[model samples]
Target chain A: MQIPKPYLLFLGDVRDALAVKMARGILTWRPEACVGQLRLDDQTPSLGIDDLPLEAGRERGAQTLVVGTANAGGKLPEHWVDTLEQAIELGYNVASGMHQRLAAIPRLADAAKRQGVKLFDIRHDAPALEVGNGKRRSGRRVLSVGLDCAVGKMFSALALEAELKSRGEKADFRATGQSGILIQGEGIAVDAVVADFISGAAEYISPANDADHWDLVEGQGSLFHPSYAGVSLGLLHGAQPDFLVMCHELGRPHVRHLPHIQLPSYAACVERNLANARTTNPDVVLAGFSINTSNVDEAQARAHLAEIEAEFGVPATDPVRFGVGPLIDHLIERTR
Target chain B: MQIPKPYLLFLGDVRDALAVKMARGILTWRPEACVGQLRLDDQTPSLGIDDLPLEAGRERGAQTLVVGTANAGGKLPEHWVDTLEQAIELGYNVASGMHQRLAAIPRLADAAKRQGVKLFDIRHDAPALEVGNGKRRSGRRVLSVGLDCAVGKMFSALALEAELKSRGEKADFRATGQSGILIQGEGIAVDAVVADFISGAAEYISPANDADHWDLVEGQGSLFHPSYAGVSLGLLHGAQPDFLVMCHELGRPHVRHLPHIQLPSYAACVERNLANARTTNPDVVLAGFSINTSNVDEAQARAHLAEIEAEFGVPATDPVRFGVGPLIDHLIERTR
Candidate 1:
């Protein structure tokens, strides 16, 4: 299904990392699906988007107004409700990727319902999942694992799936989180599953199929992320991938939010991911790397990519900028 | 709270491994609490318990008839309901640790309600758990790691806690599965928790408090089981244990049910558990081993225990038979 071009709204300061993360994910991966951005604070010189006032974006044919900033608690700020209400009143779908449910908020939900518009509270509506049976099927499985959560794992998996499909390859994008679920129209929200069955849910979606097919299973959480390591491990084991793509942002020094704790080296991170994956599937192989260069300049991004490729001996690319052509080629040849 | 003395029912072949397992666990850990066993078959010559007919156990003052055999799919067999109905009609509490809820069965539930007795569907009524924050609590954590599921991880943890308590030491039993939850009266059934929050549930129940106190956290699943590796890893991380106790049945050559999957040596299993545990808590150590010698003769059990102790250079004991005094003493002295 072709989702309408969204009017991405970042009400918080544009330079704030958490505030701009979701917006960056959209702009980088699905920029064509976005009409423009509406921000209250305008200090986002590096956002690299058509910045519009909310009314102007609607006038420009934005069908959905997406609240694109995430707070620490993922709650929708009270002040943003007026802007969301305005969008709903004008017959626009309201979408949010926060933990707080827009449908749970009486005012916003009521407004959307009254105006006959859809309310997309991405996290809250994820489907319940069953326990995994660990049955391996025919097709090759490729999973995007990241150094930390929200470091372009989903973007990379989706981008790689799109790249593969463009070349007439039979590939499926299996989402493990809400955003991927919204995009794919079908996928178990792995994180929403009861902890006992998270891996099972992952296994359920990406089942054993023919070798000609490829399942680009979206990754959730992270092996190193303090808050979500269990989900990361569950996804790793459940996916039981033949190929693993290491997704990384250019220069994240520490896990986001936990400032004092530093992230392990890139090599160490990849090694750790592979080792954990081996606990269940000893044959899991690292295919390549998908680097997120959203915050880096072109030259710097290229240099870092080259450095990572040389160090890890894997094809590395910024899926949004450089495209995942080399990585896709490598996967096709290796799996075949 | 003192639980009602249960009439353990092994309606399936009494010689079946799973049928005798629950009976063995209850008899070993809390023998005084069991009135007697009610088996449909009489071929269990090795089951060291007073075998009673269903009516006889109830007549001997049994308050509950516990359906003790766990089937492959955890579904209640159709044939057993008739006997259960008879027990319910006689006003005995019904308890089951199966995935199929005894309270959900129409006839049995109605009969139990009418008869004014409780139906304890142990796994179904496990408390809902919150996501784990992975916060290390004050007390030193001691977790039971197993070579396979049903290898007495829960029994060993409970036994150790009892031994410590009898010695006037402060120790808490933290249950992570249905059987333990049924006995403890209060515990988060970790396996029932949403996948993303399994570890968090472990953390929520075993908070950091006094350094001198100990939380003997019962483990679930197995690190080597293909279908349950995720849960095992989550528990390892969630427990964030300072100490680990390896639990293994004496004669199992491979993972139960899945043949050809050879069980790893005690050292290899302990090392693997420690390596996974070190992902979060770097200082986790294996304190000792809890060998399940129920299937072995007394001479064979003692010989195996001596061999393991010599090979690993650690204290080893069958917590049920010889008690966990040696392991507890070692843990107390080492931690002190």
Candidate 2:
């Protein structure tokens, strides 16, 4: 398979004209852009790009696109590859949806390039990175949280409390479901957030760090959600936190599916995270190093500091195991 | 610190008498059960224990319970382990709020064994392995999927399509999301599908056989959600699948945040899976895998798989890289 240099693509039920229109905007901007997230009935819904103006592309030659509709016609289309390719050649700038995964884009592109087939995969139109400006938070501090109501939320908030107190400053710890952490400019409407950002509200703070205290937030699920959309990234961009301390579950076999999809998976998460980071640009990303008990013979928590340090690029100490001091120390060092 | 055998517990909103009653039932049945899901706020909002009368056992020589309460007065009246050693002394029985991970449960247990702590922590609970079958799926042979939408709902449907065809049977593929996948005989809820059977729906006709034959069943979202309040585990014990196929995001690292509240850290995925497995008792477990392509790397994916395999002993593969055929073959071989 010819690997295509990766580009972002957003996946949705393109049969929805609004979704298709949104995708069209991306395609128009980049001749090779691909639209995705089409399910089986997409074609029946009258969203076919058969008549879309692809002629604008001999200039760019229909950016190698992959046209996937969420479903295979009663059977994998006999000329599925050919018909789709021809459509794009004839100026249909949409590829069939391949779920939300753009991981195969690079590979598909490489193959298409070798075969001299212009490929347009949906990975090319993923939402751009998130960056926002709002009430900022920052500091070097230790936080020990009680995992009660909202697990990640409490941890983030409590950690923020400790960090802010250590710095002898205060900043609001807001969990905006996507619109954003907080906006410094005039209040923007949800419509604008989605229309303008093509995502949720921004979760950001002022990059300048004007706030006297650091706000550490956790658990309130954000970032990965599409509706909350670009808001999380936007907020982070604005905050430019010294270190992004994210606490979520990494799938571990031994953990008994402990961290199921209550949230983001590793790939989309990283993609969105990096996308957000490219805009927000935090100094570091520290995943709260937690594991499910049954998943693996967890590295002996006591003897596992070196591994933690090596893997995370920072010292590792369990607060529950080691007194809260060393754990906090490492957390601070990580942000710096 | 005393380490103990951990059991997986799913305690949904303890404030709901139903939830508390489930906890009480677990205590009575398991007796050695510890570590429940912190369903509600331990403070004013929740009764904390749902009138189950936790105090009845206080006479068991100050029964050691390492309880982590949100409103848990930092200074407890008695019988709770805020300190690690105190937890060790509470051998055989312990309770704590949700999302509190044991960074060193096994190791501590081992150490305590040496120090004579004789501890017991139901942090990692396994379903009863024996599969008891009294009923079979009647109706349309709808496969109820319990996999999270996180991996995109393609797994069960995709696998269903592949498995049916491989067995030389033309199966109708229907991924019912908003609407529930229908079936008859023993009513298989999400709980049974996850903990008991290999596949949620009893039998699936491959969708690939005929596109016109497809019926994409929408998920009711919350309806499939296991009601931990009811002693649902017993219900699942009725239907045992031949082989259980579980989908996982192999290298999807972004989900690591949910574990903060001792809520299973995405590992809850597995616990929930097994919760259903306990009832269904599917023999072989086939795990379909994928990753978040946005931010993670191949190394993380490899590690995630290796780690999960080591822990669950289930066969997992990424459908994107390795087609579903090989995974099916592996499952067939394991079952044979």
* Number of the top DockQ candidate: 1
The parts of candidate 1 lying over 4 Å away from their true place are: A1-130, A259-262, A294-303, B1-28, B31-121, B124-129, B260-265, B293-307, B320-322
Q: Give, for candidate 2 chain A, the lowest lDDT window spanning 10 residues.
A: A177-186
Error of 1 at A94 (Å): 11
Can you list each candidate's DockQ? 0.33, 0.01
**CA shift at A193, candidate 1, in angstroms?**
1.5
For model 1, residues A1-336, the per-residue Cα lDDT tens digits are: 223565555454445665666666666656776777777665753467778776777788888887777677877767777778878888888777787888888888888889988887666554455655555567888999988877888888988898999999999999777667545545767777666777777788888887789899999867766567767777887888888999888778777665644567788778877866775567888999998898989999999999988998889999889999999999989866
Q: What ranges in model 2 sit over 4 Å off?
A: A1-160, A169-213, A220-284, A287-313, A317-336, B1-176, B179-336
Best by lDDT: 1
Query: How much lDDT does each candidate structure score?
Result: 0.76, 0.33
Q: Candidate 2 A-chain TM? A: 0.36
